[model samples]
Target chain A: SIIRILEERTEPKRDLEGKKVLVTAGPTQETIDPVRFFTNHSSGKMGYAVAEAAAKRGADVTLVSGPSQLTTPFGVKRIDVTSAQDMLDQVLIVYGEQDIVIKAAAVADYRPVQTFDSKVKKQDGNLSIEMERTTDILLTLGQRKQHQFLVGFAAETNDAVAYGKGKLERKHLDAICVNTVGKTGAGFQSDTNEVIYLNREGKEQHLPSDTKKQIAHRILDEIVEDMEADRK
Target chain B: SIIRILEERTEPKRDLEGKKVLVTAGPTQETIDPVRFFTNHSSGKMGYAVAEAAAKRGADVTLVSGPSQLTTPFGVKRIDVTSAQDMLDQVLIVYGEQDIVIKAAAVADYRPVQTFDSKVKKQDGNLSIEMERTTDILLTLGQRKQHQFLVGFAAETNDAVAYGKGKLERKHLDAICVNTVGKTGAGFQSDTNEVIYLNREGKEQHLPSDTKKQIAHRILDEIVEDMEADRK
Candidate 1:
């Protein structure tokens, strides 16, 4: 009974004790009007799992989330946002304080150039919405990096590894998790995921299909390992 | 204790016994690519409530719903659909046998002209998506109606009642429920709603702000009353 109690006590490793972590989750909405919008298929499971895992490991987690039905993880401070611009603002406000920043959110690349205050009435003809790019939040954080270990997520349909590797270098991220979407039991709304964890140092770890919770902890382990190696 | 037990046993009104009813709920999503989509702000709460209430009143209810997080109400058959076209197809499949049909879904007025099989790569400069109007499901139903008592919902930003009345006449609907969007405790994702009911004979009933469940029961009452009046 004593041995079982000890095993239970040590099962949770607080390796991230006193560390500050910021995780972003869900797909940011780009409003077309008061009632309609454009969005991706992100369900925020991966990012929420990461936030929960980080908090369990004694990290101070600040989760910047877009519109999702997920509840806030215990012991994590969550900032709720709607559009891509709103998410960027909140993330930037707390960017400097985070020791590690994981951009797991599938932020919108484009938004309608003109957003109406009232609901747009359907008319006789086809409606073409001219779109402009949202400010790249990850790129901004990468450009302004000082001591923070930055991480990014690449949800790809093709050339997954190559795209992720490119993002890691271009965004100056410490690592990027690449996951191919449009597959069964992987990516988007699925609870399970398979990802290629690629770092700036050209090291790649292939994580086979697993629940997002397990994948999140493994990703954290890699992050800690990479940070320690850099210190040496 | 005996009085409370007796009240519970006799409380439910089964006025819709053996009646066939079909209710459509939520916002239909029109896809642009593998990941991104266009959608409106219909939460399907109002529709789900209607289905639940109808089923409780002894109606054989079939709910054709778009993408929503809400659970299917007990004793109601639910068919989930994504795009506006999909919802239309599903609704029409069961339209023939229903005595009452309620079009509560916020079907997209427009969809991308071309839906890509793969994810669209982000490129330089602004991107413009050419859109086309989706098939008007209610109009089609109206044209094909036989003995069905059709009801439509109009979610408007301006002239809610006028738009609803126009839809009632144009769609040949027995009744139309109009609710203004972009308001507090009403429309879209709100659990509570206030709606104005208008019928073909120019009868109008304004239902003040109330829980969607209560509103649903009241709307059903109006539908039954109007149907009986027509019979007389």
Candidate 2:
């Protein structure tokens, strides 16, 4: 909807028409047991925003998501997953083929060393959760890139921009959006977001706090511009 | 219901009549942000089992719990809590007034050092959750004991008996129940449990796996026995 409203005010270049785009969203639930999990679920808002924006711009979008209550946006291909392993499994299935990939998911970094299929009892003093790191999805994608532009999102409470730039280079991302959360209407479940978008050449685009829908279009517009420039 | 169904063959002890008892249950939810939390809600099945059994035996029972889908058993006073801090706050309020306190809740040992009141964005790289130890509710209650008896639980995966004994000594608990979870139909969300009912003297009474309701009665039977022994 934002894309439709935005197109009327600007020339429609159809920049992303029929391009294959892959997006990831939501937080992985590391299972401790049937009912208990190790970490929080990422609300799929930001990933959904990006995916919706891409779809609106006529991209063939494949959205790999973690468990969430949010409905899939119109005209987006959605694949739901449960754990970090599940997300990874789903992601690798489509990795070699996308024109662009945006990793907006709050991928859980660690999962219990082993997930007990059933209930786990509390040992008297404390029951320990042995954690191990999950595979870095974005880094893997960057390494295996073959004509695809990769974008990643960074969320932080402090030192957002500095760390974001560091990751941009380390992950070899084409562009990265650094989101500093904690202010009203920013991060998590809120409809609005404020982000600092940066490119490989160190150009920064600071987006003011606004609804996710509006922010989505701005992010897509930048990516399209860079894509067009690279084509020339 | 177990009590009602089991009453067909035995005399009701009403052993806990007129005694003030408090029990803690469920998992503590550590808030990472407004919409996200760390860890699962302790099922509170075992705690509810104990509280309900006490009420059936005529004890003035108070049940402090974390977020759960289970309903409150009849005649038990229930106070719901969210985090470890909240559980401690609730426990302290009734600690001095109770004749017996059972620390059965699966209390979280660590919580995020800083919790954002709003949503937290995912940093592109691994987002870290800095954790710090929470207050030991059982140990604090044990230290503040005057004329009251304190019971603590130890749930462990390995060497449960050894760990339970260690905590019983460390917490100065009058009685302790060591639960061995990870077995089928045992621990969280299950209706059944198996435990070792023990005391300060190192005496242990083994309880076979049974419905939590049945186990609750067995646990209380031991407590009542110990209480009578102390009075004599």
lDDT to native, each model: 0.92, 0.82
Interface root-mean-square deviation of model 1 in angstroms is: 2.5
In the range A33-101, model 1's lDDT, one tens digit per residue, is: 788889988999999999998998899999999989999989999999989999999999999988999
Please give, for residues B1-232, the per-residue lDDT of candidate 1 as tens digits. Answer: 9965784587678999999999999999999988899998789999999999999999999999998999999999999999999999999999999999999999999999999878898988899999999999999999999999999999888899988988899888999999988632136888899999999999889999998988999999999999999999
Question: Which residue pairs overlap in candidate 1's backbone?
Answer: none
**TM-score of every model versus the real structure:** 0.95, 0.60
Q: DockQ scores for all the models shown?
A: 0.62, 0.12
